[model samples]
Target: MCRWLAYTGTPVLLDTVLYKPVHSLIDQSLHSRMGVETTNGDGFGVGWYAPDNGTPAIVREIGPAWSNRNLREIADHVRSPLFFAHIRATTGTPVQQTNCHPFRHGRWMWMHNGGITDFHRIRRELALAVDPELFLDIEGSTDSEMMFYLALTFGLEQDPPGAVARMVGMVERTGHEHGVEFPLQMTVAVTNGQQTWAFRYSSEGASRSLYYSTEVEALRALHPDMAFLREVSDETRLIVSEPLGDLPGAWNEVPESSYGVVGRKGEDDLLPFTPQPV
Candidate 1:
């Protein structure tokens, strides 16, 4: 449905992750091998946390990323320790800037690569469930942004995985009430400048592709002469919809129905994820 990537650890130009890889996000926007659509041209967005800003900065547009001059210009200039980039292929929503990915609220940023099955059938129900105060902040009509707000309503700031599970639970419950057998499909990423969390899950068991980069130390040992590996820190990590490149031993699949966290101290974790009733 979409392609996205979350990067944490080491401050580097956005280009390092967004444009430089052999099979970079920009390239994916044009010739994606792992997404439902070969070209994700409906829209694109990038959100990054600067050292001095509390809230993340976001740039979104309703255009293909591969040909966006502004995106290319910014990627060459902006640098951050953590950031998210996404290319969208609308499931059914209109192609507008607000419908782009990497949605933001306060210091947090989020993006997704899947959708709620038959969202229009359950859209009104799900929107009604969001907290009134938080619902006002929603600027997009995509299920991805709706999921973000739903997670926020369920306590994303305090407990990310729990909030997301609750959000998914609500979606599944609502979908079932509407007679939809498969309710959700998502590989989501969320961050609050300091830490990043990623999830891969769906109601039917089969989910979209998701991968995380191999540990920097391990990659270093595998290819000692790679200068880029030497430039970044041992704690550096990246989670993407697909492997950014064909580097040997460079990516690992995130387990089905599970979530992972990349923390400040390199205390990353992978654990089982289960939807809980709200």
Candidate 2:
């Protein structure tokens, strides 16, 4: 239902990925070959952490990423060690800035690229499940924002995987009660300025496309003449909804129903993910 990309590693100008890639996020916004829709012109948002310990800065707009001068300007000038960019195609939610992806809460930033099956039917139940304190933070009508708050309510800051699993499980249970099967579908990314966690899961076996960048050294060896490969550190990694380019070995598909972590110390780990009841 949308397209998104996350970068964490050596700091680089946002334009290096958002605009300069062979098939960049901006290109994906206009002619996405792998997304459910070809055009994600509904809206877009970008969130980035500063070089130090601080909350992330977010810029969202209610228009196409391909044509947004503000996005282009920010992409051209903003340099960050980590950032998230998303182009949205609404899945029944209104096309407003508040409903955009990459929803933020203090130090955390989240974005998703799928829908909660029969979300309208279970919206009230899910919303009521959020901690009343976090409920006030709900500013949009999208299921994605609701999912983020739900995760936080379940302890995202302390245990991301567990919290997310509980949130998903709660969603599935709610859907089942409403007579809907396969109640969840999502490719999600969340970060707290130091580490990033990305998940690929759905109640059904099939899910939206999600990929993570291969190590920079591996790409350098695979494409010896590529200059950009030399510019980034070996720890530099990216998680994306689709491959940024056609280069082989540049990206790897995240396994079905699994999650990957990009740690602050530059380590990467992958593990199986299963939802647990709260």
Candidate 3:
């Protein structure tokens, strides 16, 4: 239902991917090859963790990313080591600024690329499960934002994996209770400024498309002639909803029902995720 990418590595202007990539998020907004929809223009948002501050700055609006002049101007200048960019295509939610993805809370930033089936049927029940503190932070009416709060309610700050897993489990249960056969569908990304975690999964086992770049050093060794590879740092890595370019060895498909974390060169990690009761 949407397209997104997360970047973690050496700092660079946001345009490095927001515009420079051959099939960047902007391109995906209008010509997605693997997303459910070719155009994800309902709304858009971007969150970046600047160097001096611990908190990320988020700019969200209710316009299409492809033609938003403000997005273009900002991308040309903003630089960050960790950032999330998303293009939205509404499944069942109204198109509004608050409903945009790349939702932010405190120092954490989150965004999702899919939906919880029949969200309206279980919205209240699922919302009631969130911790009152976080529930009060809810500003939109999308399953995506609700999922974020549920993760917080389940203790995301203490244990992100368990909190997210429990959040998914709750969505599945809530959906089933509301008579949806396949309740949860989400490919989500969440970050705490210092670390980033991205997941690909769905209740039906067929998840939205997601990919992560191969190691820059490995890619450099594999295709030494490519100028872009020679220029970027060895630690630079990108996880996206589609390939950034047509480069053969530039990306690897993220396995369904799994998650990946991007940190320093030696700190990148991958792990399996499964639904578990809260």
Cα lDDT of model 3 by residue, 1-278, tens digit: 99999998888899888988888889888999998888988989999998889899999988899999999999999988889999999997899999997888899999998898888889999989999877888999999999999999998888888899999999998788778999988899998988888999999999999999999888988888988777778888899998989988888999999998877453788899998885
The residue-by-residue lDDT of candidate 1 on 43-155, one tens digit each, is 99999988888699999999899999999999999999889999999999999999998999999999999999889989999999999999999987999999999999999
Clashes in model 3: which pairs?
Answer: none
- Quote the positional error of residue 92 for candidate 3 in Å: 1.7
**Model 1, TM vs. native:** 0.99
> Candidate 2: misplaced stretches above 4 Å?
none
Which residue runs of candidate 3 sit more than 4 Å off their true CA positions?
A: 264-266
Clashing pairs in 1: none
Cα RMSD for candidates in order:
0.7, 0.8, 1.1
For residue 158, model 3's alpha carbon misses the true position, in angstroms, by 1.4
Score candidate 2 by TM-score against the native: 0.99
Task: Give the alpha carbon lDDT tens digit for every residue of 39-64 in model 2.
Answer: 99999999999887569999999999
Candidate 1 deviant stretches above 4 angstroms: none
lDDT of each: 0.94, 0.94, 0.90
